[model samples]
Target: MDLFLSAAFGFPTVLFTPMLIVVLGYWIFVIVGAADTEMLDSVDTGGDAAGLSAVLSKAGLGRVPVTVALTMLICVAWFVSMMGSIVTSLIETVSTPMLWALGAVVLLIALVAAWAVTSGVVMGFQRFLPKRRGDSKHELVGRTCLIRIGEAHEDFGQAEITTAGGAAISIPVRTTGGEVLSVGSTALIFDHDAADDHFLVTAFDPALDPGQH
Candidate 1:
């Protein structure tokens, strides 16, 4: 204990060790979080079906909120402890060996704690994210929606469709075969083109489809 206290009270390394760990670990998390990996390719982001499977697969962080909070807490604590250690060391009159021992013990504890937190976050993310099911765009092909804005020509337009949960989405749409869809007219999502970021639609009267043929 004497050796530990003396080392901690004399060496500058002890004061900055925790701060280094925290900063370094945080950058690691950021890189993992933002990377678009192959594992995320299977998840879907279509309307209500969007979930965390893609996010976690790419970043390896369980829940976004938990990962963010834990990282921030670790960083804050590290810097705070680092500053505190420096002040305490300056005021102390301890022996060199003792201070060194204390610094070693503190660094070990901080390192272990940081590792545990990182592992926990990774595990949590893997466990909570759901497995991908299937493509939903295929099902939208025959569904009807209303033109919320301008006409849907071969090039550009917008429309609104109520999704499975009744949530509405204003998405870019186009006429499947150059048919013009006027405002408030009913249209069907005939095709979805990811590259163009728009849906190929067709004008259709629901009442006519129902009876008049």
Candidate 2:
């Protein structure tokens, strides 16, 4: 109550107040189903997926999604600012120049810490996430599956198909030529696009894909 307000609205840490608000707002949207993790991975700056991945890898944030990186950054900002407040408060008469220098150092530390945290978190979750087996994906080629996400774009999306064991496997998917499949739509995976590491899914038609019929 009082402590939260003090930390959030007080000096130094108050700089991250807006960031906290934004992060919280994003999670709220995610909870209510207005948004999803795909938004974080879909920011394109006129580069292909491989180029974007390369840039992210060079930045030490390749494994972490953009939203996860941003969330970790905001958390680090709040932590560093609060730490600065605690340390600065102990000083009897700190000058403005000295305070600025300390702030700069704290910001640098925050940046490094945020990157480390993001990497660590992504690695930690990797053990629990399912990996697509090369052999299995090859067999799924030309199989029809249901699109589970909001929309399956040519770049990134997900599809769901049930297995013999009654377990539903969700696989990352993509298409080409500006094709986008809405949620609940059926698609026939034509080929395994190895370059993009996703199944090249096409709209399913009864007459077209006799294998499915």
Candidate 3:
């Protein structure tokens, strides 16, 4: 047990100890229902969450939450730390500065590798995971939505909708006619755009659209 502790707290592996601890503690919090509300709301298409997700969405990780992304990073760091320790252990003797330098380089490489692996997993999840309850995307067509971003264009935009569970969800949206939709605008999701993979929205007025009710 002492040997195991020494190895874990030793040079290279020690670098990732902090991250591993965080990951474990985070899960514990989630299990006990003490998870952060901020994380749950990150998947929202509006507000600052959208900006952060825009970069991740470009990287194919938009579906993944920030907490999950962070967890991935920590998991990869722990794995890399263990690998580094093994490699360094094979060496006879090394100077303190050299070890630190090696750890720094490993940190850079680990971060890149972690991002790749995390994004890959997130992409995979999008293909198989349940997106909206048990309903398929096709079933969501014709639903009404509220624009949640500054302006929703054919190119970029987001909207909020209420689910059968009475939970509000934010999702990507686009105009069917390439029109611009301002924040808080009401729209009817007429169809799904296959090319862009988002809902095609049309201007809707509760007073004018009889189908709104």
TM-score of model 2 (CA atoms) = 0.53
Q: On residues 1-213, what C-alpha lDDT tens digit does candidate 1 reach at each position? A: 554455444344445445556557656767888432222223232642334434543444433433343454465445444544554466566687866665566566554555456656556674665543434666666777789767778887888776543345577888855578898998878788988767888878688655336
RMSD of each predicted structure: 12.0, 9.4, 8.4
lDDT of each: 0.58, 0.68, 0.69
Q: For candidate 2, write residues 94-149 as lDDT tens digits.
A: 69787667766666776677667767776788667554112256767767888997
Clashes within 3 Å, all models in order: 9, 0, 0
Candidate 3 lands at a TM-score of: 0.51
In model 1, the worst 10-residue window by lDDT is 36-45
Backbone clash tally for model 2? Answer: 0
Model 2's C-alpha root-mean-square deviation from the true structure amounts to: 9.4
Compare the candidates by TM-score and give the number of the best one.
2
Give model 1's clash tally. Answer: 9
Worst 10 residues of 2 by lDDT: 42-51
Which candidate do you rate higher for lDDT, 1 or 3?
A: 3
Which residue pairs in candidate 2 collide? none
What root-mean-square deviation over C-alphas does model 3 reach?
8.4
lDDT for model 2 comes to 0.68
Ranking by TM-score: 2, 3, 1
Off by over 4 Å in 1: 1-45, 48-135, 208-213
